[model samples]
Target: MPNPAPVPDHVPPDLVRDFSYFTGPGMCPMRGGDPQGALADLHDGPPVFYAPNNTYDGYGTWVFVRAEDQRRVLQDAETFSSHRRIFEKALGYDLPTIPLEIDPPEHGAYRSLLNPLLSPKRVMAMEAANRARAAELIDGLAAKGHCEVMTDFAFPFAVGVFLEFLGLPQSRREEFLGWADKQFHGTPEERGEAIRTVIAFMEELVALRRREPAEDFMTFVVEARVGGRAMTDKEAVGMGALLFVAGLDTVAAAIGFDFRYLAENADAQDRLRADPGGIVLAVEELLRMFPTVLMTRIAACDTEFDGIAIKAGDRISCPSMVANRDPAEFPDPNRIDLARENNRHVAFAYGPHRCLGSHLARRELVIAMEEWLKRIPAFRITPGTAPLTYGGHVFGIEDLRLDWEVG
Candidate 1:
């Protein structure tokens, strides 16, 4: 039998209407023009509010909209644990997607094994390879005059990096792309199937690597250890699957949205084109304005958090999409100020669980923006096509068409 609605009994009647974190008709609506707009209004109403709209088996959750509050939840994982049993219940399976699913001390060990590949220096060393890939993709579209940036450039460029990182064959793009969609955008059944498919593939790959090792992220995990003992096959598979999902989704969507914004805003495009040197800083500001992931935490004990009563086992969501838009933390939070100062945004999230791949993500975005602007002339959204969007755990721009001058 399905669970009943998770709405709490103590929510103020007036504030009940604003609980818009989950999807469905009466649930919170994602602000139409601005993805974060509904959340901006939400910040005005409550620091932490009960939202009954969670679509994962109708579970209720606490929505955290303030930056400081978000920081508190993410940093203090003891109070707000990272264990994701919600997925277990929703998908009807046990999936331990490492580091991200574990809290503190245990998480550190898993993170350490992968840290070398994502260090700033390592990511910087890959700039030449990353730039070459970006240029290759952008060159193909330069002569065509217009293209769907999301499909043609963003997805391929980002996924290409992921493929190279894992030493996976490029011929498998279509097969893996299908799995990615099912894992993230498909129906619950499709998502469950996708997880099974990925795990199966990883188990096979790990078995192969065990007999004949190679130089890649997967091989690293297969050979790595935790606490002086080798990682079990299950642990390696969990880490690999998480990396596959995280690597393909976030950076690709971010690059797509950043280009979509630039397509509509000529001034911002012109400024970056002229300065060139400012692309690094521009990427930071862009991330601040368009953070896409909403992180989840489960409360560890019955406790009072920021005047709100949170019971043990309740769920809390700290969306970087919401926290980055806090007015008090960011002045003129709605406006995209490329020159914004002291931009301490949680676009990569906050605390111990902050994204391990942030350095690589940043490098990819910066190279992508710089390379695209260099090759493609001034571009704008196709006059009549409606841009398609999806909002949920990971908000995405499904279709983005751009028209540009053909040389």
Candidate 2:
């Protein structure tokens, strides 16, 4: 095991916990592991504690386990800044991931510019295409009897929709998927290379859109104005890079986890298959139970939070999985209630930086489930195989071999 970062003197010794997203119990890669469920145990610990070596880069972070505290910390952006320059280490320079890293007043303008493009109405309009894409992928897989979820349907379907939105050619689908895999799951050196590769692609895309404007997201960004001025090259590249990274990974991972859940729970699968209308609500419940992202913030200045001393630059981690499982937030938090009401779960996060693509993501998930159940019959994890799950910057499942009786 690598050496853990030293705990800051200001952090009370009693508050420090030997926890890490990369190395925590059930967090590491394991077959049939429940990374998110493993984190639910955090509720039994202190509401807030310092976790040494929690981040991908080996920095200590203050972990908030309760939904209420996470909401407060996430909602109060000024105190806990979101501008962590997350891609700086990989890119070797500071490149804020657009509106995600921008705070409040400045964040508002960028969000306003992009929100309408992905609003509920817009997502509804895109549903037909999304549905068609999901159906096309599922149709191709139905005859196979058994297939790996990620490569067979999840990544292709999710990334296809993302590529369509970005106006990229589907011919490069495999190439783009390769970059995404490397960036998210590859070794450190490979991840850096993938990051650089994606950035280069985005830069080229920005230039292409500027010179030969098209009716696509990149083109819109190239010509769009933010803060009463045209977006700079860096800003355009940042936006595209953020979209490429964000759009490709999380939704696909979500689809993987969602299918894994259905594969294990035949009753849930049968219910959703019998009552397709319930899928919309079921998707929300599934999201609550298996969220994959961890929101991290850097302290803007030293301040006391709930009697805890937080110094400037301290990392605050608000794990959506842990928060979603907070008993105070959701009664019987571990129960998989398909008809869960008033969920208000933070799968997309809370406050100003809530995921901009949440609407699109929700639509994609709902459509995926609807199409799968409509086309494929009851299925389960293929016998003699297991889905490998891991926790890190993001939680993901792989080798999700699912099987069903063939005609």
- Which is the leading candidate under TM-score? 2
Once superposed on the true structure, which residue ranges of model 1 sit more than 4 Å away at CA? 1-4, 8-18, 22-32, 86-93
TM-score for all models, in order of appearance:
0.94, 0.98
- Model 1 backbone overlap count: 1
lDDT of 2 by residue, 1-407 (tens): 34667899999999998888888899999999999999988888899999889876678999999999999999999988999987788888998888899988788999999999999999999999989999999999899888999999999999999999999998999999999899887887788899999999999999999899999999999999998898999999989988987889899999999999999999999999889999999999999999999999999999999899999999999999999999998999999999999989999999999999999999999999999999999899999999999999889999999999879
Error of 2 at 210 (Å): 0.8
Please tell me which predicted candidate would have the highest lDDT against the true structure.
2
Superposed Cα RMSD, model 1: 2.4
Give the TM-score comparing model 2 with the true structure, all chains together. Answer: 0.98
Candidate 2 collision pairs: none
Candidate 2 residues lying further than 4 Å off, grouped into runs, are none
Q: Report the Cα RMSD per candidate.
A: 2.4, 1.0
Predictions in order: lDDT:
0.80, 0.92
